[model samples]
Target: MEIRPMRSWIHHRRGEVLRQGGVGRSAMPGVYEDMLTRHGFEGRDAYLYRRHESTAWKRAEGAGIHLDLDGRLLEPTDLTDAGGNPLRLFYNPDGAVSVSRRSANMTYSARNADGDELYFVHKGTGTFYTEFGPIPYEPGDYVLLPKGVTYRIRPTGPDNYFMIIETTEELGFADIGPHGRRAPFDPGLLYVPSPELDDLGDGRNQDGEWPVRVKYQGGFTTAYYDFDPIDAIGWSGDLFPFKLNIRDFRPITSDRIHIMPSGHAVFATSTVVVGNYLPRPLESAPDAEPFPPIHRNMDYDEFLFTHAGTALGVPMPPASFALTPRGLHHGLPAKVEEELRKGIKPGTVADFEFIFVDWAHSLVATPEALAQKRAGDQLREGVAAQ
Candidate 1:
């Protein structure tokens, strides 16, 4: 009888990285082809390609749509000044993506019975008045209002910016699995709004009535109340509005490999998954780089919002968004990869803070977003003028 410890050998052949390290060359033919075909890169000339330094996809024909905007410039004041309502960037039957700006307090509360509201405060200080209480929010807070929750925003100043993810399914923390009870942070640390009864002109107008608007079945219906919509004296529930600061998120990292996108997931619904990418230690492996691998996500449509990050010597300004549909090859630009190959010291902190969402089903881009896309010569001219 023979009992032996097996050693796994990682191997490379013909410019492809393979996992059967200890296998002899005579045993590689079938295994190599199977691996390539399974990954959808099969070809007689199939080889690894890097997208780490190339931004040419922004102009590529037939590429999945991507959007990058000066999110910081997309303030509510600017939208109102430009005579536009909150702008929708992408949408589908399941959900929608948009940005909203508010300069003053809202007079009426809003309740969306169709879906949950996930608000990322890109800029502004404000109080989110809800049935549970007055929840104070500021930049970087992720404020979640579950379906049917009445709420309104009141900014302390004249400017507020928010990115809204309206998911048809309710949003909640992703299952952390073996990571821990709170892989990111404990639920007790979540900022549950302290309930406060509002004093709205003695609880009512001369007519002794207040108003709350419910958005459902496609349109709004106004509901009259004897007191303000936020006049809940007290409440308790596992399902209530709360805020989680992105700064408080502790991203899972790896010492020797690039952490998979799933490792960064913070919020999830049956159809949508949102990841918070904060500054963290980069992959320390000798061959692995501090960027995403070139591949496709066949199961989900993916997007990234660059709240902050520096990549390949370029500072990815906050508020930029990018979308890549399933089966598309996307990753770091070529220039960024080139810089990484030259070597960045191990343990250097990655200067990136962003959010990524993967929609399990396809998402449709709005015509307005398509119309706004500039490429090729037009894109060049615009950059030159800038």
Candidate 2:
């Protein structure tokens, strides 16, 4: 049997650094500041100041930061598939992120037998007609649906956008921790719809022999219903779909240092945890760097949807998405890094809002997802400047 070495959490530092923590401290000249940490900035860590620094390494796999494929450019199945489904973009064993461009009501009620589904309303005002009740959703609202629940979205506006996340396990609100249950967003603020008692809808989904689309094990099975599926007179249970809007989210901030991304965790399944990166103040200490340090997410893959606003004045277009694998260094765009190196301006606030998933499994961007890169570039090739 092989034996493992004992590990210690003691602090050890050498070469050009006179101290341990980099907070309010600057490294010596000609030193490349890079940190290697375990458990996403937690656990034992090391700050290495190397003599050489370069990103000129060549060739293959997750090559560049892809911010070109706008979410609106891709065509979802709701526009093409006869049954009306979203377009699968990035997926893994644990979860998947798909984009939906829906402007009309779904003809068939859909049920996911595979996993719990959640939709981030990027752009739309719609009512999610579920078996329980009708939950009206707006932009920045997250519509949470339990697995095997019957539901269909009916948009009341044009250019409706949705980014769907489906996971194998049920997702619950992340722990409130030291702040308690009411700090981030009170459980009371969650709008759990009551079943429509008097009237579900006037002649809606009344098409003869209405179909219920059931997605199971990568294939779909349709079950025909003799009447409308939203015929629930009453519902009494703890397990039901609900909505949590971004407006209710209270962020954790610190002017001393740029807090870790985990501080913004909102929802989590057994295998994945979702983080909401909302607009907030940046670090303000005189000697402290105001941006995330150059580090690798060693344990989980990072996938993000840039929803809106300027990311610290860095021009990441709204609705653009990007994926940084587990081992690759996180991208610090040139313009943003320059401001970081100089330390952020005092009392500066970043208005950028994004939805990111720190999934435990390595993700694979689907072929149709990859094809969007080519299609996007071609579409933008001859467009006139605004």
Best by lDDT: 2
For candidate 1, lDDT tens digit of each residue in 219-306? 6787888667676788877788999998888878776666657677788886687877788876656645455434555666777777
- For candidate 2, the 10 contiguous residues with the lowest summed lDDT are 377-386
All candidates' TM-scores?
0.78, 0.87
Q: Which stretches of candidate 1 lie over 4 Å from their true place?
A: 1-16, 19-63, 70-85, 200-209, 371-386
- Colliding pairs, model 2: none
lDDT on C-alpha atoms for all candidate structures: 0.63, 0.70
Task: Give the Å shift of residue 344 in candidate 1.
Answer: 1.5
TM-score quality measure for candidate 1: 0.78
